[model samples]
Target: MRRRSFLASSSVLTIAALALPIYPARANEPFTEGQTAVLLRLVKDIFPHDALSDEPYLAVVEQLASAAADPDFLQLLREGMSSLDGAGEGDWIDRIEADRIAALKEMETTPFFITVRVSALFGLYGNPAIWSTFGYEGASYEQGGYLFRGFDDLDWLPEPLS
Candidate 1:
């Protein structure tokens, strides 16, 4: 009985010791509730569902919002959002989306658009099942062709491009 109890206790302690490094406590990082809300709202707006399902979109938004709250991710978002605001005259997402489209047309450039576009792209691309819907084969050569491509052709492009 004593030997059994000793072995059980030692096993428990060993298991716990192994888990400690695998599950270290994350440091507390501050994030404003308002900012988080805005990010969620923006993600939902960018990827709304009609009658299919909301789970995938919601999950993507949650992941993105969590990243947005992180110090490093937040810095990148802030820079992109600030650039969007500076380039146009409205809310951050709207201005950035609009400005990005305009710049893409006028300059025939994609880097500016990519900064904002990639965020939404990532939200969708993160899910392998979602990528499969459009017949993506998951090769580097075929990756670009699988992305959302209708933004460039929106009616607003001509005016902004000119």
Candidate 2:
């Protein structure tokens, strides 16, 4: 096969694999589509900075999906989503202004919220696709590590006393 076709096929497989529930799927809950969507929304809400696009945010979605494959973690997510769904007079995601704020405040300390929040903090910000937006060159280890790369290349500091 041509290199282009191979790459295309590989990308398709990768996406399909990501969409699949993690191995050893829980017999209960089983990570439904609504639950996954809720997780994605939760991650985006927690990191509501405009600098990022939805692409990098998928890292958080993937992490939460994997975690949900664990029965206990799935329970946390289910309950959190339950609380989230019941938070407002209408749907939590659709509540306007103060209503949305109130809903978020109510669920801020929930296990699902905390789990998704902590996971997104560690998992989302570090995605390489997110780096270039802020002029980050990413890890130096791959380029013979940071030492040879002159990580402390800043020249703005005043000269040290001789």
Candidate 3:
């Protein structure tokens, strides 16, 4: 096969794998499948990037699941999930997007919200695989900075002086 065809096929397979919904069932994970699903959906709501897939958001859930193995974190996470479920009418996950965002906003000062928000900042943006979605090319200092790269490639911004 030609190199171009091989690369294209590989890209397709990678996206297919990333696009699959995750139901984490690792040994010693503290969360139930239902809780994990809720966490996944919550992560997406927290970071609402339309162009990105669920893989990175699920990574945050998995990370929280692992942390929950510790007794203290486990309690915090359980309470957090419970709070989220109680934040809106019916089940929190089934609520409309606007309602969900309002519920989250109400909890902005809570420990759970702060923890998840901080974790998500790193978990979502730190994933190199999804960097292309935001037009980021990873660290550029090692490559002698963005001066010579596409630093000026953002067409949405006004043109720079020559």
Candidate 4:
């Protein structure tokens, strides 16, 4: 093949590859579809923010899946899934909201539950996109602080004494 043709083709291929979404390559998937579904449900139930979409919860699960690459973490997750599934009637994923909440409450003290709770807290709330929904404008330090930026805009408060 001509050098020019080869270079052009290679460049095209490189650009195409770069344009594609790049997810971290995992040698073995951390969770099966069922497990992933359960994780999604579990994280959503943990937070129960009806205003937010599934994207943030999914991100949390993805983060957890990434952490599950470690053998120990994977084992913990698998065991946790089993315990959750066994705790109540049928699969935990199939349970109604009340049942699921009850099941989660039962396992609240477990390490697995704690890990997921902390992960959900940071994953769901830490996302900048979520901040707007909660009316959190984020840190004001970068914008010269909140002193001049509606610092006294609390309409719910009683008027201050002169």
Candidate 5:
């Protein structure tokens, strides 16, 4: 009888534990595809004509936006923009373009807009898939951990010093 009661109590506790929300998935809200495109265009304008072309920036922005369907990520983005004083800048695309350029200029001596644009250029140029597509082999193997290594094989010491 005592064992049965203990088992019942444990089961209830286990169920409750499982039911608790840790990090709930963000709500699905409509994201304007046009806005995303505009942001991409602005990112491109900021950072144009890298060796890998414009693929890296486009890919990252797309991936980030897709992943940003999560409320947490979107909220973080909103917070970051606010921290950068991006309120009421304009419509979604215009605001992003204007605020991003403004932030860049305000934060650094090297024309802020150009710096971000250059950053986008470098980011896209540095992506492995983009590099692979372009037939460029610089530092290919060095970034393999993030690009290809499977989770089951992660190790700390003696990093694949190849």
Candidate 6:
């Protein structure tokens, strides 16, 4: 009995010790499929781009994913995902978006939401694919500025009233 108890306790401690480092892996590692999908959905909800496809949006995800590679960030994201809570895959995106935004609003002043929101704000818009979707050909610094590039010709928008 003593030998069995000793072995069991030792095994449990060894297993726990082995598992300790795995909790906080580096942020550079690719996220699991479910995590990536959840993250992509989160980004879309935060910054909806109707004209764009999944490709461009995924680019934004990749940027955020790098940030999420940090264990701290991964924990933050996991918490945020949980905040969005148990909506089904079939649940309406609008409903999910509303709920998640509300959850985030609750944590608006916290570092996690702030970091995520700011990162998404900057990362999502800067993709060239997103720019083209909005009819922005990007900076013409070498060729001159927006005057020559027709900066105002935004194709994604409806024509203004006369």
TM-scores, each model vs. reference:
0.37, 0.66, 0.72, 0.76, 0.38, 0.58
Worst 10 residues of 1 by lDDT: 19-28
Which pairs clash inside model 1?
none
Residues forming the 10-long window of minimal summed lDDT in candidate 5:
19-28
**How high is the CA lDDT of each candidate model?**
0.45, 0.63, 0.72, 0.75, 0.47, 0.58
Better model by TM-score: candidate 1 vs candidate 4: 4
Give the per-residue Cα lDDT of candidate 2 at 157: 100
The candidate that wins on lDDT is 4
Q: If candidate 6 were superposed on the true structure by all CA atoms, what would the RMSD be?
A: 15.0
Estimate, for each residue in 1-162, the C-alpha lDDT of model 2 and write its tens digit. Answer: 222232234343443443333333232245677666666677777777688877667666766666665566667677877888687686676666567666777776654555566567656655677878878888776788767666667789985777
Clashing residue pairs, backbone N/CA/C < 3 A, model 3: none
Q: How does candidate 5 score on lDDT? A: 0.47
Candidate 4 per-residue lDDT over residues 83-116, each given as its tens digit: 9989988988998999999999998877678667
Stretches of candidate 4 exceeding 4 Å from the true structure: 1-28, 155-162
Clashes of 1: 0
Model 3, 94: alpha-carbon shift in Å?
0.7
Deviation from native of the Cα of residue 66 in model 6, angstroms? 1.9
Clashes of each: 0, 0, 0, 0, 5, 2
lDDT of 1 by residue, 46-107 (tens): 55435425555545545545444546555655554445445556654544554545533442
- List RMSD in Å for every model shown: 18.7, 11.9, 13.5, 14.0, 15.7, 15.0
Can you write out model 6's per-residue Cα lDDT over 1-162, one digit (the tens) per residue?
A: 322232234443443333222122234255777777777776776687788788755765676665555566677677766655543344333355667666556666654555555555656664555787776677678788877667687889898899
Q: Output the worst ten-in-a-row residue range by lDDT, candidate 2.
A: 1-10
Q: How does candidate 4 fare on TM-score?
A: 0.76
What local lDDT score does residue 16 receive in model 6, on the 0 to 100 scale?
36
* Candidate 6 clash pair list: 27-69, 27-70
Indicate the residue-level lDDT of 127 in model 2.
64
